[model samples]
Target: MGLESNSMPKIVIGDFGYTLEDVPHLSDFIPDLPTYPNPLQDNPAYSAVRQYFVDYDDTIAQNIVVHKDTPRGIHFRRAGPRQRVYFESDDVHACIVTCGGLCPGLNTVIREIVCSLNYMYGVKSVLGIHGGYKGFYSKNTISLTPKSVNDIHKRGGTILGTSRGGYETKKIVDSIQDRGINQVYIIGGDGTQKGAAVIFEEIKKRGLKVAVVGIPKTIDNDIPVIDKSFGFDTAVEEAERAINAAHVEATSFENGIGLVKLMGRYSGFIAMYATIASRDVDCCLIPESPFYLEGRGGLFEYIEKRLKEFGHMVIVIAEGAGQEMLSESLNQKDASGNKLLQDVGLWISQKIKDHFSKERKMTINLKYIDPTYMIRAIPSSASDNVYCTLLAQSAVHGAMAGYTGFTVGPVNGRYAYIPFHRINERQNKVVITDRMWARLLSSTSQPSFLSTKDVVEDSMDDKKETPNYALLENGFADAHK
Candidate 1:
């Protein structure tokens, strides 16, 4: 239940073209480290409360075996208590920077990091790096103190601001050296973490003792091995409002269809969960499930059948879903090198309209709602605030403990330090075969497959039979045909 027996820190060789020789061993520079001072060691109040700290079990147990090398799986130890830190209080100078797109808990994480470094470790020289990685070389920094970041967590967004796509290695290291900053916390997503790994490798190559710790920040919740990233719960909560609005709009009019697009560049957690939470969604589409447009049991046919059964339908689709259906090129990328996904919501809406107009000479009123910016700009929810605070505290603990080239996140249901190499190995996507997907299917009542031989054979059997227009007098046949 504790990582103490197998608490060997592993050196991770990053995927940023760094070889094994480039990484430094922990024993090389940090041998015989001193334990953190116990301020409560001599206090009379400590004797009564000492059992709380001594018997604490913050190590998380894995549900299944993650790797063959470790049969019991990986266990993440809590980063405080009697653990020794590599940096001295007055000698330590730390920097915090936020990068990538906006998430709900960025400001909360920043505030917690500043507070932890100042109060817990008594680190005085904490600096807020502005404009992300460029802030290092650009000399845009604000001196951080306990008073400066006191009320920042009350608001949303980062106090230091954020940017993307500034991974200049030499200039960043030179600035670190010139400014005498020994510890750095980079908060962002996958691309930002990759840049952090490169920066750490550069620091090690220069033989500097600077520690780089990453705090994973992605609203998409796509980081590998992390149980849930900060801002995801808030995003899902905010997205529910949009889904509810769409449902109201769809059901208000005749033959109404409300199509909503949420953020999920490579994965579909937001769309999947929002559909489950909203409960009014007729169909849910995501990047994990490939959907077709005009087959026997395709999306269009499903919508047509739903309209016939209930006069209206609500669809929730992730941003990255149905990208293959787009005929245009997606060569453009954002500042973080992420591919710009095509507008699938608009495309689907237009396609549905055209299909109804051209094939059946019928009109379908469809409304498209894109609430991506609104969801990402909101403040953190109550759950995300707690999650972000814990992440920040753990990150500061890792940096103080001389752990570098790693990200601090909740892994296997516990807050743990995850190496960057493992993060970049693969993307975390929703498994369509999982219980979550099964729940989604049950909630939406959508068919699992877009096309099937049985569906085609049944259509062929229907075509072979004589036409039955007895219900045409009731106006149902005219409305559909």
Candidate 2:
């Protein structure tokens, strides 16, 4: 029902190996900012709580599983209510906006933000900015209240609506200033968060009191620094239905092949997790792990082997997988500047048919299923609903307590506040060498799809590429210290 800080102490082991940066605050730029007792201290809803405020020094570690001799690494400020707040209840005018693509828990986050502000802090003047960042400048604002968004969480998509690539920092901040809006809640994916960071810089440059907070929204679960994005569980759950259908269709006919495509533009969490859950998939392909079609230890050879043994097989692939193998060159991008991906599911389906009917001189039945939209438009699962509620409430508490230019999400099962740059800089990808991938390989008994040269090159690249953000070892100050 409520959230608390992990309260991990900052431990610096070496001189040049670790850095911890804190999120910006209204007081950071403005001088002598006044503080008031948190409104929650008087609210009957939180009265029974023993500790109403999080410690200022409370933080969560970024790397929890390092070796005993390794450094403690980075830590983020814990997310919760602060004993003193900057804005008075009646003085706060907040607005919520959802950008980029649709995700399952968008409405849940929106509902919780409005409800928390109204019931928890008595901040009734909440406005919903329609149609992404452009809404701030072009569209009329919709007044939001606890009653207005009561049943929204049961539905899919954001009630405020969403879009992409309309981020003009000056105009959006102008709208905020003109309307006297001090709190801004932005919900979107990586690109949207990048835009949010720009907006925060612009606000700080203009000396505005606006608090810009981001809630990372991606069904792909690619946003880094968080355990998983909010709607990832729901997406994985919905993807299983498609995998099951593919399995039935494949098993029904002789030499049948079921090919299912799920969402994962850059990361393959959906396809990986969904395939593992189904336990019927013979192979799972993602962007992180390179795959080949021909030659020994190739996808085609594996498919042939599986078909020979089982008479039928299922394959699940992420949307972003197998781009290099495609004959067609799709050098295009969408509104958010994400590359338009060629359909790997269809390509592999055709490839499989050709390899059997044309190359191998054998007949094979192939079924292609693309349930990307269906999975993206459904309501969140029970667990996701609770997770979204916590994220939204933590965001509200942080904004009320004057934490600005940050995003809120769970780190190691504990909620924490992170700077926008830390998350937007790089994505959280599936590690091929990790235990999870090993488990998937063990379950499917599929080849790694990696050659000796690929393995050597990957190792060289890992050693050569300096981790600018992974450890945050350089170019940032130790804000927690």
lDDT of 1: 0.77
lDDT score, candidate 1, position 459 = 78
Q: Which candidate number has the best TM-score?
A: 2
Alpha-carbon deviation at 147 in model 1, angstroms: 2.0
The segments of candidate 2 whose C-alpha lies over 4 angstroms from its true place after superposition are: 1-19, 451-481
What Cα-based lDDT does every candidate model obtain? 0.77, 0.86
Compared with the true structure, what per-residue lDDT tens digits does model 2 show for residues 30-77? Answer: 889999998888889888999989999787878777776886677888
TM-score of 1: 0.85
- How does each model score on TM-score? 0.85, 0.90
State the displacement of the C-alpha of residue 325, model 2, in Å, after optimal TM-score superposition.
Answer: 1.2
